[model samples]
Target: MATDSLPSAFTLFESIQPGPVYRIPSLLYLNSHQVFLAFAEKRTSSSDVDAKILVLRRGKFQDGSVEWDETVELSTAVKSGYRSMNPCPVYERLKQVVYLFFNCVEDGVNECSQVLWGRNAARLCYVTSQDAGLTWGQVTDLTESVIGEQVQHWGTFSVSPGHGIQRACGTLIVPAYAYIIRYRCCLIPPGFFTKPRTFYLYSEDGGERWSVGEPLSRCGTGESEMAEIAVSYGNRVLYCNARAVAGPLSCRRPSRVEAVSLEPGRFEIVHPARQLPESDSGCQGSVLSFSCPASDQFSWLLYTHPVGSGKDRWWRHCRNRTNLAVYLNRRPLEQRHWEGPWVVQSGPSGYSDLAYLDQASTFACLHECGDRQPNERIDFRLFSIDDVLRNIEQRGRGVATSLKHRQ
Candidate 1:
């Protein structure tokens, strides 16, 4: 079937604010028919920046519409003195709790870069909401528990942590990188570059406290950003990451996504692995969630920007265009190949978050779009799986009939 003919896009939701909003993250819960959008609102004053979490509930109306309502605010001035970004929340079915986790920064600087230096105390914290997202309990420090005895040097190790959801066993795994500073020629002080080890932490008691796990993988890659980790049917844990390229000023690297087995305190990489298309630039892909209806069966959906081979390769420069792709398998934890990267929506120049709702019948994405470019206003778009499947089927039939006639 022609890839372009497939239903490549859907209208999940739209921008809510007049200005541009960025760093938006979304979570969808199928059992409860609920969707949550969390992001940081940028203000002219750094202190005015606040982290906002919005809840959208699927209504019973026949029109196939959803209603969004603001539930709680984790404002910098109100809740915590630091600015919150990268909000990641996971729902615990057994405990009936939703744990909302976010990255907190004191000065509101992008920790990914080394220009701005701060304390190593930056963290990924959480707050729980029992009744969906209507109300939130007191904020809890999940970072402290994650980084138990890990020493922070020059306030770099504790910055820019990544997290994932292990839905099968209801475990929330957070991965953090250890960083070291090196002095640049012109730059006043040295910048922070990720070290070799990757640390993981999990919450078995519903985000109240996290137990630290040993490093999963180690490599010569300057900085390895943890994206997603899932337990496959074979009882192996897959770890995905974006590796940093070697160079003084080069931020590009061969994007490496690997899978590993989950042992007591460590893991090993899986072979016959799934890899990105050659078109992808060295940018790392973010795994949204692993959905499995039956035991030991699942699919891992990831979002990444497409790029070509070379240093200046820009594939379809839809600036900051976010692409959706998936890898499915029926076997146990054995390695498999990735299928999609079915493009959903692009136009805005920023990161987009996706969630599956209503038993995967509905898919929603929340991202930044506006006149301000990159970080502007936050908007959401929803699409029905049924509609997408119908389109795919129609496209498939067209391909089949054409092939038969040609023969």
Candidate 2:
């Protein structure tokens, strides 16, 4: 572990309208010479809130210096209707194109989750850029075929997946989950029972086309999200999941985080998963890429959010708090457990959209802060993996030394 503190990178807040509103699942891409970030932004108005994509670029962030580029809007009224959110971008090196995927909903009322409601709701569309972020190709619909027959009735349906990665074999593996509302009474809206199932889509020929693969896990009664790790120990592919189980109607279930190998695409109960040790009310968990350092045999870092608590029915006030947990592979994962939900960034401005880059030497985290005020903006920060690892090691050593002294 390095004794010095991790350096903070440059942060930028997009300038939208009355309220700077955005959604989760923003995309970050690195194109040899520059870095590109695409996120959805919504501006409230008298009639409806207009939504568009805000693109930002910079050469690098060392020495607190940056050649910040102007923000660009990717959506138009004629093409995108009035609502758009959850922009995910993937850089296709072979094709020399960057593909930006997002969900388009009608008006401002339907969230990606509202696809469960019988409404002309969310669908996945994408735009391509040949010259970095300077220009974009035609906006094309990508979800129609993948979700064709599954989304027939309006009741409610959503297949908003998280970060996507290209496999070593040049296959694009997109981790997604489908949530459908099943039953509802007068007091509670129907289609509120979220049945989340994990699945993947692959693109054999670059990003030109994709094939829907088998469901990663059985359709469980809960809200679930999936993430994929490209390289693990022994070069194995691993899949991570965070499931929000529905507790009794009077109370909510505690969310749990778990992982499994991609060969089987099933979650094995390796550890006793639990929500972060804060107020379970407004907490959501995400499993960032996992890595095992060359020096250590059993050390891995799991980046996630440690949102403390919330009161609103939907956890509207839930803020994103960056957290990392260190695990020791002393025994098999199914036998060993997790330790320390260490705080990385804790505040109203928590880090979201986390990605591991530069061979796990650097980590990039993007998050939005502030209330829905004009000042609300998205921030991108890069941290040294060494610094994070050192913190975890020091904590581990402290615990070990204490145990030895006591014994």
Candidate 3:
């Protein structure tokens, strides 16, 4: 218990009144240059409609500490009535270029209207940077290029608001979800239910040419992130995990949607005997697949989310956002469950982005934390793999344990 005083998590931005508020953290680590980039949405309020601009910070490690430069606001030149949402993938090392993929929508266009009326005011837009995020190139429109004939049928679309990944074969992939509305008889679908699915956008010629992959699931999947995984026998697979929603008049249960793809965009969704629990918060969670040299395996999947259970699973806003936990699994294709949660944050926590500092043998997370609310400021927590699996023994038995009982 005495070791609890040691620092495992720290704050990057503190909350203040009548000033800037930050949310939606995105972290990118450039291993070649040992640089870290953090991106977030600088909002006027905690509401979804208050997101005005995307802000970024650049930093480098020195003596086991990272010092960040001055905060820079990444401006979007959309029309006065449009706003940018979900800034993702700030580091593109393949072509020696950086990209920020997000969606621009007209102001006052909410999700309910778009979902109910089958109308979308959103456009897939992006910007590039050659020399890091110091200067951004002109914005490009990807809505018509990636989604040509299906553009109209897409009720609305947005990125996952996290770091995107590049496949081994020189393909830039960004995870996203859109509403696929079909008009049968009235304004809403049959029995007031709607269709939503997860998809990915890929670029082959380094942002010169782009195309959209097929939907990952049939419907009801949204806000997904994809990570490339390597097997022991020199085989690679793409894994996508999405947030599952069970609305009223819907028989679907609350769970996490999981799937895999050997070919980009062509996924075989896994329907296991049991379903992964959706975080009590119901917000987006972060997952990263990385190789573990210490462990005698190819790689492991690391995930972060708020862990808890409540009586009412319909609405998550009323649930406590405490006990932000991290889980690890080696054989994702065969295993039905992951290991210990290793409770990291015991207080109000929200959407987080993680970066594996391999050389330092630690990982970093940028998340939302506060005393009474989760929107006060986005925090950066530093931890190691051993700390995550403190006293849990591994015999290939499927059970998730935790170190601290703070939750």
Candidate 4:
């Protein structure tokens, strides 16, 4: 952890004193408009099944500060008798269209029941905005057209709860996951005979046509996000980081799962990321890649998640969701080279999404964090690349000094 404290967080969404609560934050930055669109699930309570509406707040960056507008409900983004959740926004640069993708789950139905029973009650949907979120078009349901019969086999599925990516070649990629039913147990509290795997939805001709990619070969990975970065001169690949779901099928240690796609849809390599720790039962984190400050030919990856504080092996249990940290990987292809959990928030924190402002050389993190519990509020923080590098260097020296004393 960094010795220096981070700047105070700017609260964007909070739980209304007693009633309605907000959760599942997704952040999108439009380079051309110089605007940011922050999305969240407006629920009657903190429970996932209570999600009722999809809400958004627009923030315009100017004069070194973000001026956010009042929250607006995307009425068209929902379906009758269903709850909207997991707000994922993707921008089509050529069309100047921003597509907000989310899942509409059947009302009163929770994920556990759906998975255990092998019944899917969620729909894949999205709405678009042409004028930088000033207005949105009608909701488009693609569950039948794209997913088709395949969805029936899925116990339940969802799109990335954060921002999606657009490759340099004009391909749009949305990270997603599904719990495929393996069997059914007739006993009470029926066994969850299912396997969770990460996959993606992609579009080649802007947002005109979409296709589902093959699910990752590895199991027990879910709620993922992707970033397209240059690995070499004129060469780029898609980097993915996902929540490591704990189960009999998962890895022995709790850690984030990572993979890379040589092209657009298929993940060529999958492995457990030992360097990044995942909260027990897993929590959705965010990853963003940006050009190295020293050279545009190379890129670096930034990740944000809650870092366990206690020395006990079981420290990542629910109540201990504290010390939100941002890690950097200079060599994106090498999972072992990750560095610096820069401890941005030293208290309870949860889901996070990252965005880079090229003009400012700054990174913005829209995250779930609070003084007592992580779900109490969603806050934002802006820090520079230099800030991360300096803190990481300090942490490296501290570790080296400790090693010398032990020897």
Candidate 5:
């Protein structure tokens, strides 16, 4: 399926959804049908509570290029005036089903107020589709059942705005985060939000049923994503990449948190995790595990983040959202062992999602990028695996050399 021609970037969405800003882009590749689905939250502004719609774009690969169909904007009819957000699509190859996970919060209720008032404003919901993105089922609210007794005490939480992992042994896990409101106090004004953490829900039998898993030990964990890489026969490693959002006063570092697991539901935070040498804007990034034929290896990890060079210009680089590079992790289990971060986009680029097409050795990136600013539009770019490797070889010292090694 390799082609000599590279696919031109295509605009999936702009400021046409009644406002002038779009955020949180997610991309998923469906090997079952050769379809790529892009998900995002449509908003009038950057406010978390201002999100209005959950938008999706579906397309199939033809002649080594993308052929996108019509956009499918969705709004689940909830009982209250809640806005849908964080459209995460997970494809189950065993059952051939696509489960779309999202959250909804009351229209006027923002995230901070929800935690400060000791309230749980967000609801975990999902919808299913059999024929890729052609049609979808009704929204199935899982807050009460999945979160169960903790819904009242647990503060508002939401799924990672990207793909989930279905392990090689048929376990489906969706990464999520929540602010622990039970620890909030009237005098403290939601002290628990200073240390948000990432957790996950797992389903053993496809997606028919689900249950919450143990939260990662690292605090300040924000949006998260997970992928399974098999290390040996009948044994696999679960790698989780998360955004660690820490306030200025908090001592918890805001570097990307990486965790590994041998069991199904438990994750242990690996210290000295591989930190992306990118700007410290606390932006959401994506990670994928794919087969690299040239290496004769088990699996390789691909990560995306905003890469910058200078210390004084960190804020400027973070603001411009330029140089979104892709890093490769050849050694999966080693702590902070990463290499070859080749810059894929030299211009304005921000929050991105990656999906590797195994048949073509090509990676599809759906990211927020523009001519001068990052959020002007969400564009899709395709890169061959060989191109990235070549960039790393020619550059000699890989981009991973610039990564900050924190203790």
Candidate 6:
């Protein structure tokens, strides 16, 4: 199928001239309510320090179309002198409550300063809504109670900028990462070296209490999302896909890092997924697990991100944050079995969040894409599994024909 022939995308949030830009999309779909909640950071400009507040829009899905309501600022989900960022929403099934998790950073403090000085300024917090986002409760600060003294040992930390997942076993998993200080030198100005690693904030009992799981052993991993996948014979495992923050001297190249955890507090890091490429300097992506469209007993994985090769080797002019694509994998545990990067958006694109609409066998992507800059506006697109399969098959055949001519 041709990219232009697909359904047209809807603009959920657009940036105006002299103010209030939108970025960092977080999308969640509630099956019971047949509704979609889209969240994003409303910033004064494109810079991170200019982030002001969180905004939300509720969409009602029916008859193959969505009616999105007006966008509203989450005024109550903020602190006195802090800016809210990284909206991570997870639904609790039994109570049918939605927990909107985000990081509240001090007004002027940026993440680079936090990593250098080994001082943490970001606070882990959330708010709850019983009516699927009609109204929200007061903000609940979880940094002090959950992170505790450990906050001093590291730099900055934050939750997933997208939606979290609730396992079939009733465990709520919120993907997160922290910059841990590895070396400190006592001098005129305190010096510290830190590296990013991924972990989870989980609640086993209906969102009453939460605990921090152990960080992944590998370094240079950050800004992640999680999904619960059922391996062979109905054994559930947690799968994480994170942004790889590779440095000049680092051994690993820039790519999306994958890991699996059988239980909480322990993660087995898999090799970087070569098939699913990352943009240069790394960009956040989303992963979602759903039952195969054909089979009920097994699950498949769908990941959405930019299609750049994570370097200047391939596309010289546009090396990063371009060509938003979605890759499909039938074998969730394997690293090299990914197929079909069905290009959802062919131009400038940035961070994206994916949600499965089971009623129509479609996947929805809320992403940042624009003509010049990737973060200029936020848009949403819907495509079915059949669409992806058809595109992948065509691309494979074209590649084979090209190789044959070269031989």
Report the number of backbone clashes for model 5: 0
Q: TM-score of every model?
A: 0.68, 0.74, 0.88, 0.96, 0.89, 0.95
Error of 6 at 386 (Å): 0.8
Expressed as tens digits, the lDDT of each residue in 1-110 for candidate 2 is 11224346445655456555543535455636445454544445312235544343433434423455655566431144535555556667777677766666566564
Model 5 whole-model lDDT (C-alpha atoms): 0.76
Q: Cα deviation in Å at residue 245, candidate 3?
A: 1.0
**Per-residue lDDT for 1-407 in model 5, tens only?**
11123336888988553564777898888887999988887788866777888888888897898888876676552325888888788878887898888888888898777766667778899888889877888889998887988766666788888888788778888888877653655577664544567888889999988988877887777788888886665567888988865456544434677888777778865543545643355777889998757643478888887764333354454454566777788777776767655777667677899998888889999988777777778989998878777765644443345453431
CA lDDT, every prediction? 0.45, 0.50, 0.72, 0.88, 0.76, 0.87
Give model 3's TM-score versus the native structure.
0.88
Least accurate stretch of 10 residues (summed lDDT) in model 4?
310-319
RMSD of 4: 1.9
Candidate number with the higher lDDT (3 or 4): 4
Worst 10 residues of 6 by lDDT: 309-318
Tens digits of per-residue lDDT for model 1, 71-190: 334432123556555555666777767766665556544444432352353555667777766567776665555565453443344322223555355566654444543333345544
Q: Global lDDT for candidate 3?
A: 0.72
RMSD of 1: 6.2
Each candidate: how many clashes?
Answer: 16, 12, 0, 0, 0, 0
lDDT of 3 by residue, 1-407 (tens): 10122236556666578877888888888777777788888777777777787788888866677888878888653446777778788455676787888878878787767777667888888888777666887778887877877867777788878889877677788888888865545644532445788888887777788778888655677787778888765688888878766555544346677788888667876542133566422567788887765663477888877665334354543365665667787677765767755566666777888888877777888888777877888887777776656622341122333333333
lDDT minimum window of 10 residues, candidate 5: 398-407
lDDT of 6: 0.87
Q: Please write out the lDDT profile of model 6 over residues 1-407, one tens digit for every residue.
A: 23423547999999987878999999999989989999999998999999999999999989878999999999889999999999999999999999999999999999888887888899999999999999999999999899999888788899979999899999898989999888777872222478888999999998999999999888888999988887766788999998886665554446788999987767975678888666447889999998887776778999988875333453342346787887889999977888877777877899999999877898899999999889889998888878888887777787799899999
Candidate 2 vs candidate 5, TM-score winner: 5
